[model samples]
Target: MDLKIFSTLPILLLLYLLDCGSAQSPPPRGCESSLESVYFNLCDLNAVWGVVLEAIAAVGIVITLILIVVLLCIIPFIQDKRKKASVAIQWIFLNSTLGIFGLTFAFIIKFDQRTCPTRLFLWGVLFSISFSCLLAHAWRLQRLVRTGEGPSTCKMIGLVLVLTLVQVIIAVEYLVLTTVRLNNVCSYENKDFVMLLIYVMFLMALTFILSTFTFCGHYRKWKKHGAHIFVTMFFSIAIWVVWIVMFVRGNAELNKSPDWDDPTLSIALVANGWVFILFYILPELRHITCPAKKEDDPPENIASSQRNPGLKGVDNQVFFLEESNRGIALNFEDNLHSPSYRGPSPMGRNVYSSPQEFTIPRPHTRPSYHPTPLLQDPYLNYHNRQTTF
Candidate 1:
């Protein structure tokens, strides 16, 4: 019994020593500590990548603001006779730009109950508004070119509002559901949030189809606007595809940290916003601001025509000469007597009147005579006798 107790004592002492060694050692590093300790805030300036994203977001916001200002400044000078009707589209575009700017805020600020809702709601609604505007624009172009009829500006605005309202409904439903189930925590799994994008995807698809049809149908008449819509849609689709893949699939394998999701979204917002600006907004702005070239006449011809209204008659005469089958001589001296002439110009200038008085000759009138054969012979004989003498 004594020997057994002595052996058990050493085993117990060894166990105690092991426990002491573990307690003296530092705590094991947690996943949160390792990943989150590096970032002091949402956009940690200490990290290079975070700094890059923040800078990009900041610059994007600034550019978006500038675009808004430019749009406002150029509204009066748009030179489009339909500027009143088109103002809705411009305002929608500005709203979209503002949405893009808002999206960056989601990344720049730390995630919380408030910001989470903003990130989720604004992203869906703002994007919907923008693409809805595109859809409206494309639809209008299609109808105008195909049927020579279009909706009124108010109807167009209504259409856009209806389209965007659908998205608003979807977002609200999502937020409400999330709030009820998650105890008012705005946090959502990326996959679930992405699923909410189904409606957005639908809007995008519709925009693409409408834009493609518009582009194909009116390529001849509305080449610039059609191409702009087509290219912008195509570019947006590419960006969406790439970012969706990265955010949903690639991030799991490639992301070095768990906090990369916001950055990914922020990057996408900036890139997609710039794409819209570069492809759609910038081109439209340029088209709006720049004066269109007149293909009918040269600048000098236009200037001369404006300066001298009398030359218009000469042009008309030249056109008439070119059209006529028979050659017609124009007499400058008799031009004042011509049917086309007025007594004097409004400016009191005697354009083609001659100073000298002239008269036209008339044919003389005479009685007709009939002669018999004897008279004709006598006359001929007398003429012959005189000639012989």
Candidate 2:
């Protein structure tokens, strides 16, 4: 989940400052102002942020890749394979790779000092957003498994379909932009303006659409399940909103003469990357399993356990019959003991062992007599002699 989303904040600020530097008129040092613009004023600061962001993002990329490799390492060992888990893992890799590409391209944009690379920027954004969607899908899968049946399967399918359409549309736009740039129709200025508008609109539309679905799904699931889904959806929506809003505002600032001294836009983008990990990816890290407690065992069989609990049988009657046949008596040795048995099928009466079955053994009598204390008493000597006769 710690995918260097927040780690790139300083870099994002530096980039935003760079963008703003281009938009605004130079500082009023007049004719004496150095030929080197404010953009390059702190040559060291830009390079420092660049190196730091690159290093952090690179580390994140490496970590994410390592995590993916680790997951893949043991995938073959799963006795009964989970197709959903496999799908989730594949998406995780795609998400991480896309994220790495975005960070790399962001560095490229910074180092090159040009906004003409629309395709890279656009694809970077698309990949970043796609990562979020994939993460949410993984979360949904977990929720579905945990709660048995999730809220309307139809809704989940619909949301994924919409996201797929958005991705396809964005991909087509990327192709078109790439083609346009190839034909030389879009120069540095036109590409920046056109690409900015397109990117903002695309992101806004995506954010709004996704927000609708996320909220609806969360709301429906919340009512059925609990507050967990609501919190998750809220954070997810917040991330989208923050990104879209900052993107739009940044574009607006750019259009209004270009000297917007703000770092919100870069922060927003970096935040978008991290927020997905926080809200969606983090939740899928662990799965819900049945609780482990000794008291969770069935009341009837708690005492039968040897400190360590074990499942006896599914059917109580079967368990009782097996125990009785094996000569294990279920008597009221303590107040905690319940002589009463609650089997799957209710019996008409309580049965006890026969007294004759406890008689003393005799050479001329039954060989398998279960001797009792009464037969060993001195008072039973007369009876023993009588019986010998």
Q: Give candidate 1's whole-model lDDT.
A: 0.68
Query: What TM-score quantifies how close candidate 2 is to the native fold?
Result: 0.43
Model 1, span 1-389: residue lDDT tens? 99999999999999999999875653223223344332334434454555566676677677778887887888777654433466668677777876786577666555776677888888888888888888887887776554434567888889889988998998889888877897775666777778878888888889888877765442234446667878888888888888788778788887543477766787788888888888988887777665545553433465566679798788875565443312211233355466654343332222224445433222222364332222112112323443444
Off by over 4 Å in 2: 1-43, 46-52, 76-101, 107-115, 118-125, 128-166, 174-233, 250-266, 278-283, 286-389
Models 1 onward score TM values of 0.63, 0.43
Model 1, which residues run further than 4 Å from truth?
Answer: 1-43, 147-149, 217-221, 255-257, 292-389
After best superposition, candidate 2 residue 49: deviation in angstroms?
Answer: 4.4
Task: Return the number of clashes found in candidate 2.
Answer: 4
